[model samples]
Target chain A: MSALLYLVTHKLKNRVREIFHRPSELVLLLIGAALVVFVVFTGNLDVDPGAVRPRAELSAIIFALYALVFVLTAKNGFVNGASMFSMADVNLLFTGPNKEKTLLSYGLFSQMGRSLMLGLFILYQYSWVHRAYGVTLTDLVILLVGYGMTAFLGQMLAMLLYSFTSGSDSRVRLAKGVFYGVIGAFVLYFAFLVLRAPEGELLPKVLAAAASPVLHFFPVAGFVRLGTVGAMELHASHIAIGLGCFAGCLILYYILISVLDMDFYEDVLKATEVSFSAITARKEGKAQEQAPRNVKVGKTGLGKGFGASVIAQKHRVENRRGKVLLLDLTSVVMAVVTVAFAFFTKQPVGALVMSMYLMIMTIGTGRWAKELLLPYVYLIPEPPFRKLLYMLREQLPALLMQSAVTFIPLYFLLHCDPLTVAAFILARTSAGWLFIGVDLLLHRWFGAGSNKALLLMFYFLFCSLSCVPGAAFAVVLFQILFIPLSVSVLAMAALNLLLALLLLFLSRNVLSASESNNQ
Target chain B: MLQVNHVTKKYGKLTANRDVSFQIGDGEIAVLLGPNGAGKSTIIKCIAGLLRFEGEILLDGFVNKTLDAKKRLGYVPEMPAIYDMLTVGEHLEFMLRAYKMEDDGTADRLLERFELLDKKNKLGKELSKGMQQKLSLCCALVHRPSVIIFDEPMVGLDPHAIKQLKEVFLELRQSGASVLISTHMIDSVEAYWDKAYIMKDGAFVAERSASDTTEASLEDLFFALTEGGADA
Candidate 1:
């Protein structure tokens, strides 16, 4: 146990030392800290009382978010199991002189630490949450605790479920049946409540259904949400019931593990290996989202291409195997979820912003980024500029398709002019391409094997800076010159395209070999 | 022919390869013998044009980073870089198309020779390490490069695959293609290497040829040069 403690402390100390040693990373951290401070201070701004949304709506949304996360996490555990241990831990700590129970406690402790780190991102939304729901600082703290509890308890439930169901077909089937049955019951109950309300009052009815007392005692997610909202509302009974539920779950897990004396190393080994490979893939700029279990190896060859065009052909074949041709999982999820969000919230602009945010986060991990790591990109007999264009050939159509699916529906929902909607689509597609261009320039400047977290910070900073010129131009056109919104947006889209082209031209040498063997 | 002239590769202050110059002629097989971190792989990468080095490398009179040189040179890295999504056949096809070579039936023949014809449909990720190495070898060979560089090629291969690879090297030599192999396994290339360069501290300490070193075994020569008993 003491050795484990030393390992954790040493790792943390080294990480801190590394950050301080790197001036760029240290500056980025300071900038991040300043942004957090600004956001928190801005939360004190006064807003119209009548414009503030009801607390029930916010609680309902948080409840649904928790429920969705916990459910998906448990399902992942049922299929692939959850792992808090990395490959290094499995290799070093598991084979070392350590007790199994002590290791398990360490894993749980590490998971809690990760949950706490992830909760800090919620602080960025403090200003908006305050304006919407008039939440106090203490209430925000309670919300953070609720988020921590949900994430921590979700993993605990996954571990418990995995330990119980692994290596038993019947047990897995039984678990699946119970899981689906519970989800089905909740859906039917929610639908019943929503249908019983008047047709025009759908959002209110859905919120009412979520705020029902029956759901307050439901499980890890519901309990955490209940305790959070109860603390904010000063409801004594709700807090008691919610906290009691969590206590019960903790006691049950403790008793089971103690009584059973379970050996879970083998069960966790596979999950840990998968997680390690996924992390490695991310570091290498590969897309690991769609790890298909059963790929339909349809037609075998890279269809038809000469030198650099073979890269695009190869990507098409890979996308077919991954079943992500024109619209990938990210695009589909973004389109469906954002459209539904717009339907409920009646905020098409919000949906557009959300979709763009999701696109920026995911577009960096495309297959073209992985191509830079492979030798074929450099080894192919072609000009560097030609290779760069061919490498990104598949991305343009994919971006166009993604924009079409997401923004076409948003057109009618926003009730805006057709030309403006078209300009929005064009702007969105160009922005996605701009992100790819930024990624290429980063690889060219910093090499592919640089620290991903630091590179990601640079990525975001560069992307935000890249948008400034076009945004400023659009503001000048629309505000000062009194030009139409559609024309201003189209001008922004044109500038974004020009910038992307310039970036691509400058980063042509990214295909050239480097000292860092990214493979 | 592959020529590496005064090639020096450094990572910051640590020089991995120091003024390394070597050449492998047509119809010849040259082997680099070194201990770990002796700059064997660094020079191999330099010849393959996969690193920035203070050097001049030419593949048949073309600069190493030029398209003409890339079209003529093939490299098998220490780690087999097999695409997880592409099938075995697609891997060869990819190499063929990327090199702008016509379909010459060489891919199928090589797969058959390596006993991988039946698993041609298997994805690269599904193969074992040995199989992946074989597929990587097949990809590197499908284009029939004039100058081929292999870095630790026999590490993960099974005995049969290793035997097949040794035969392939002889065939390549017969075809008048320049071949350079880097390995720490002394006995692996003992039978076929026309010339051997023993490297230590990023510099070649000794060079031996098959005809010149008939009295002493190659292993003895390697040990003598690397284990601090002999001078350059």
Candidate 2:
């Protein structure tokens, strides 16, 4: 126990020391903290102080959003396959003389870092959520606390469920029942909202339904509401109830773990190995590292390639995942949800948000596509540029595939201009290429040892920069030529294409430079 | 067939491999015997053309980093670089395609020899560490390079795989291929090495050939240079 404590402290101290040593990372942290602090203190990230409590209609709707978020967390916890035990802990603490209690302690304590990260993200989302949901400063703070707690509970639930349900028939069925019951509540609520609302006045009834006490019965939804219900209504029992529920959950999870009798070594090891590989890949600038999927292995082979089987090999691996699922079911589900959101909210930005999401998924800001990590690449007899082109050839088509699946739905739902629709698709596709260009540029300039935060900052900066020249040219052309906006979109596309070619030309030596550095 | 001359590798202020020079002629098996952090892997990497070095390394008279040199050189890295998604058979196919070579049944032969033919359907992630090592060796040997480097090849292997590896090394030497093996286990390679270079603090302290007059085994000589005697 002492040794584990010492390890924890030593790691923390080393991290702080490392941060101080790297001024780039230190500055990045400071700036981010400053921004959060600035936003919170100025009271801008709250609903207008002069504003009154929203009507029953609006409160209900806002509560629906909260419930939506809660259910998503619980569902995510249920589905994600990884155990909370990291590779380092598995290597160190699992083999150590600690009891399961100590191991659980370590796992929960480790979750604090993730909670802190989520809290920061919540802080980032504070302003929009404040307006959209009409939450006060106190309400926002409570919600942040609730969100952090929810995230922690989600992790604990994932661990517990993973252990408890492993190879158990009844438990698996019960788990299925609980998940469906949670989701079914929302579906039933939506249906009721539709039936109960006055003719042609849907939003108000939906909002009213959200504030109903009916939501306080669902497990995560109920628990999270308790955390914030106090701030919304000045009731003291809400806080007590929320605290009691969370505490109860913790105790129940511990008891469940005690009773489960699971030998989770293999699960922990698989996760640890994947995470370790991910970290190594990150260090080597192989950015597209993802959550390891349980790929059903059957008939896997590099069927063929045009002297570029390196690319073919990757495609083969993806193909084993099945064509529809190659982009991942989560991504496809998110796309569907986005379309549903657009249909309901009647907002075009939903599509844009989905596009941005897909861009991040495809581009993987940090991952430069595993070209440098594996040695066989450097050992390959092909020309560096040809190898690079083949790699891009694989990704560009993948980006197109992802775009087609995500965007094809938006055309029907968004009743906008047809050329505008085309522009969005082309522009989103171009964004993925542009992001890759920026990524390659960052690697060419900084190498793999570059601070991740600072590198990410510069990466987004470069992506924005790539678009600037084209956007500027489009604007100038629009003013001079009096062209239609669709033509401007075409102009933008031309410049983006030019930028893509230029970036490829400039960073063509990425392979050779990375090879030299890797040595 | 492989020559490394004055190879110096530096990572920032730390010189991992300093002025490391050695040669292995065709039909010769050279062993790099060193303790952990003795820079054996660094030099092996330098020779493998994976790292930039201050000095020259030539593979069969070709500059080490050239496509031609890379084509003729095979390296099994210390840690097996297995693609988690690829099956054993796909890994070999990928290697063959990368080298622009046709399948000559070499992959199958090597897999059969290593007893890995049965596990060809398994994904790299599903394979145990020993299997991954054997698979790595199979991929490295499939290309049939003129020069080969193995880093800790025997670490995570079944006894059978280890025995097969030893047989492969002998066969490689017999076929006139220069082989460099970096390992900390002194006795494992003692029976097979024609020459051994004992390393300490990133430099070779002693070089001995089987025909040398020194009566001490490689272990005794290694300890003498690394720990027993304090060099002035």
Candidate 3:
């Protein structure tokens, strides 16, 4: 038993050392530490007025951030580009003289170091704040213990969620639906809070009642219960219950590890395979069935004609052409989802624009630019203008499809004027297209994946500048000069388009010249 | 026809290919013999238009850097140039799309010829190195371009696969494709190639026609050229 314990600790230490060596891990640790410090210092320094109780709101915010971190770290759980506990690794381990339980213990303990670090940091900061707020030493200790328990519970829950969703297409779909539904419900609740403060007052009671089981059993709830006890100066019963919750969480964690199976690793691998298979199936089916096979050859049999031979030569080259409808369909579906989410959530138009920007930046820009721009400029045999014309023709269907999705949803859901909706969609789509063009040009000039940070910075800047207040101020400035706000918007759109075109020209010329010089 | 004119490539201060020049006519099989890091692959890549070089290369009289020039060129890199996520069939389909080829049975026929038809649905990562090399050759040949450039094409092949590949090269040459193969497999390619260029220190040290070196053998000629015994 002592040897087994030693093996587990050694493995855990090695895992921690490996994680610390990674650049991303270092960055995350620093960010986590800074965030903890900020929350603690702010919570302690800024005392809210008329607050007879400690701020549960601030604790909820911190916990939410911790949950986000938990999700991200769990998703990126691979070590050195390999899964920590893959089926193949398990099989290899089984072949060795080491016992299965020992290997299992090592795997389980490997994940504990990072969780322990995050838990200790949160607990330490919260304890500092609690002590400063005149909490008793016993209560502070209980809160710290509760925080550690909560962090462990969060990691376990994340892993369990991953395990449950693995290799189950229907379960994944259901999980996504439930997740979206919960987010929608939260948005609705926030909207109610904003619009009807009196009704919002009833939310805490509802939440407290809903949180009863959590208060009794959940580790995070134990921390919250401790906070409530400290603030209200409650009896010893509450403190006892909080301690009981922490103990229960520890027991549950051990039980979970004991029951874990090889199926969990197999399921994760299968999930990846299934997802890729689905994509491949869809692409193959569509391309094979729908795409046209032939184009009419020019009748004037310039059979040996230079242009004809060029055309013949091009025809001989294997071109992977699919129907433009696939991309159009994707754009339409994405736009519809964005508009629906925005309208139902009652987000301002600016928020809708920002969401559209993010969508286009990630999905549309990367893919469309890779497919349309790179191929035309660098791969295909055509004049630059002709290539540009081909790109416009190819992308028109997708543009119209996205426009219809955006306009129809906004008109119906927001009760906006048809013309206004049209203008809005046009403006947003134009901006998106311009952004895609710019991204393509940047990618070509700087090399792919190089300007990701720069693009992100630009996105944030664009979002800030395109807010309602900024737009309104611009409109007022234009009106003072007796110019129409519509004209200014058009001018802004044109400017963006011009900038995109300029970048395109510069990239094309530079790449072409470089290629020529290399030759 | 493919021609490399005083071509040189450098990565930082280390020269990969220096003032290397060679030519392969239609229906000719020209092998580039070199040790590792001797710039044979660099010359092949430059000819294939996959890399930028200091000098000039021409594919059938057109400059090598153009997409039009590349359209007539087929390349098989030393490492299997295949998407791991894509199956053999999907890879074939993607090649067909890139080359703008109609959905003919050309890819299927190539697979059948290479005995890879049964494994066409398997992902490239699932295949053995020999099978992967065969798949790479199939993708390269599926388009039937006029010029073919291969870099270390026999590195990971079984003896049988290597023999089969030699037969494929003969077949491709018969079909009028100019072939330039870079490989360390001098002994195997000895009887197959019409002409050979032995490179050392980023330059071609010897060029010998099959007719001229009937008794000497390619391995002897290769060692002679790279061992600094030949005077350019």
Q: Which candidate is the best by DockQ?
A: 1
Calculate DockQ per candidate and list them.
0.57, 0.46, 0.21
- Shift of residue A424 alpha carbon in model 1, Å: 2.2
- Candidate 2 vs candidate 3: which has greater TM-score? 2
Cα lDDT computed for each candidate against the true fold: 0.82, 0.71, 0.56
What tens digits encode model 3's per-residue C-alpha lDDT throughout A1-519?
A: 665466557766886896688655666567556765665565554433453234443333334443344334433222111133544445555456765446645655554554555455444345334533434344444544444445555555445545555556786677557644654555465455445544444435433433334333222443445544543456566656655665666566545544654345453354334334434433321111122323222221111212112322222221222233424444654564566445433443543454455455344332233333211123333344434434333344456456666656666665666655655655555566555555445444542222233444444444434333434544665676656544555444555555556655654533332222111
The CAPRI-style docking tier of model 3 reads incorrect
RMSD to the true structure for each prediction, in A, is 3.3, 4.4, 10.2
Candidate 3 CA-lDDT value:
0.56
* TM-scores vs. true structure, each candidate: 0.90, 0.85, 0.60
Superposed on the true interface residues, model 2 gives a C-alpha RMSD in angstroms of: 3.0
Candidate 2 error regions (>4 Å)? A1-18, A21-28, A34-106, A126-141, A195-213, A229-241, A259-295, A322-326, A333-354, A365-368, A408-414, A452-454, A471-486, A513-519, B228-232
Tens-digit lDDT string for candidate 2 (B107-136): 889889988899888778788879988998
Ranking by lDDT: 1, 2, 3
The local lDDT score (0 to 100) that residue A293 gets in candidate 3 is 25
Residues A172-243, model 1: lDDT tens digits:
899789878888887787788888877775567788888877676556888889888998999998788778
lDDT of 3 at A164: 52
